[model samples]
Target: MAFSAAESKLVSIFCQSVLYGVYVVLFTATTYTLLWGNKARRSVRRHNMLFVSFLIFVIATMHMATNFSRIVLAFIIHADAPGGPAAFFNELSNFTQMFGSTLYVFQTLLGDALVLYRSYLVWERKLWIVAFPCLLLLGSTATGIGILYAFDKVVPLADVFVVQLGHWITAFFSMTFTTNVICTSLVAYRIWTLNHRRKHGDSMRRHALRPALLLIVESGACYSATLLALLILYNVDSWFQYVVLDSVSPIVGIVFSVIMLRIASGVSTEEGETALLGESGVVNSGGGGVQLSVLDADPDQKTVAV
Candidate 1:
């Protein structure tokens, strides 16, 4: 059956509501992490935590503001009233759709940057490895801005219209999707490779932090899956696209915030702990990623004094 206008509105609102619910809960966790997790860390760690919290808060506030705008627009231009659908759609085409989506796009970009940074660190700060994602990020940013600009110039349409500027929108999301996939895969691979290098006791080493890598990998996977879903939904030419898009910022913020929170709380494996404590210099496995010790089959190379 074809989705009714009311049904489309409901889907967007319901998804928005649920995602905001996730945001509120994450903000609560973020508050706790800020209060307790930064107690003993170096100034840099504390500062980094503050920065992450600030970014996540910005994203949450932006999503909330955009949703409020939509609600107000819906009330003002009741789609079911006489000539209401035309007025409502025209307003959307002229303003609300682009404005609201711009906030969503920026939020996604911030999330993408976070993962890319992590991947860069994971790869021992290998500039060449991160070059492509950084370029894609820049392209995504430019295209997103272009889309917003185009949205304003286009005359309002009588019906919900997507196809005219759809290719540009698709390009932005595709770049975003690819960037997330690459970063997530690199970070996860680095962690898995680190663990795989050891024949045993990765579980027992600095037991407090062992779960951190797992958390990072799992969160990366979850967010990557969401990006893939959003890309697919966007291509479907339905209102359901926003259903996925609206939820994205909060999801990305929550996933990355949780990882940072855990890290702040000192949940790290031995190598991570080594990096955190400055025991060994920049082994990729240590989470420092600046200087990497060459891995070898020999026992001596494996035992580089930490």
Candidate 2:
């Protein structure tokens, strides 16, 4: 059975609303924890995470609001049109739709950049390590902008499956997905390697690093998996892609907040605190000297102490 455009959009908005509700709950809990929870306060990364969380949430909220207004415009304002809501929805160049696309692209860029930044941090700020991913990020940015530009020049009632637009959209999705996968893998590998090399009396630190790696991979999977699904569905011209697309903004927030929440919770544990201190490697002897723990296998390798 062929799913009408209007039906697809309705389903998309419905799913988005449900997911946005969940996002709101998670965002609230995350913000509260970051602001007042004792566990979250001790994390060195708290402020940066909190700020990004708030920004993602605000963008998501605006996305949700834009979609809501789109529903109103399509169903009520255009009720008397020839084909009703379906016809209205077919107009790919609608202002609200364009704005929604802009929001999605912006959120996606932010999410990818966050992953890149974390990867850089985990890899000890090695520029060479992130060079390829940086190029991919640039590709994503360029292709994303190209998509919005194509949206403006497209016909009022045109669909997204057109040749030029489809190509740009596909490129954008592919680059962003690649960027995320690469960055996530790099961070996870670095942490795993460090965990494997820890010596005796480092069980606490091992425990801490293990969960950080796990949380990172798990959270990254959420976004990357959804994006892959969207990419495939879009290529297949499935109307169901609308549902996935609409839900992505909130998913972004969910993933971002969940990671911070888990990290904060983990850091609150005794093992995690000991691990953090160990990683910090501050010693107070008679001379008051400082000690730095080496994480890399090669002693001569210039690497930041994890």
Question: TM-scores for all candidates?
Answer: 0.77, 0.79
Clash counts for all predictions: 3, 0
Angstrom error of the Cα, residue 246, model 2: value is 0.8
- Taking all chains together, the TM-score of candidate 1 against the true structure is 0.77
What is candidate 1's local distance difference test score?
Answer: 0.64
lDDT of each: 0.64, 0.74
Segments in model 2 whose C-alpha atoms lie over 4 Å from true places: 196-219, 268-306
lDDT of 2 by residue, 1-306 (tens): 867677888999899999999989988888888878776786676798788988999999999999989889999999899879877776767899889999999999999998788678767688899999999999999999999999888876777787868999999999999998898777666655644443323444455654554545443667888889999989998878888999999998887777666555443221111122233332211122222232222323433232
Local error of candidate 2 at 135, Å?
1.1
CA displacement after TM-score superposition, residue 114 of candidate 2 (Å)? 0.7
Q: How well does candidate 2 score on lDDT at residue 194?
A: 47
- Residue 233, model 1, lDDT: 69
Best candidate per TM-score, number? Answer: 2
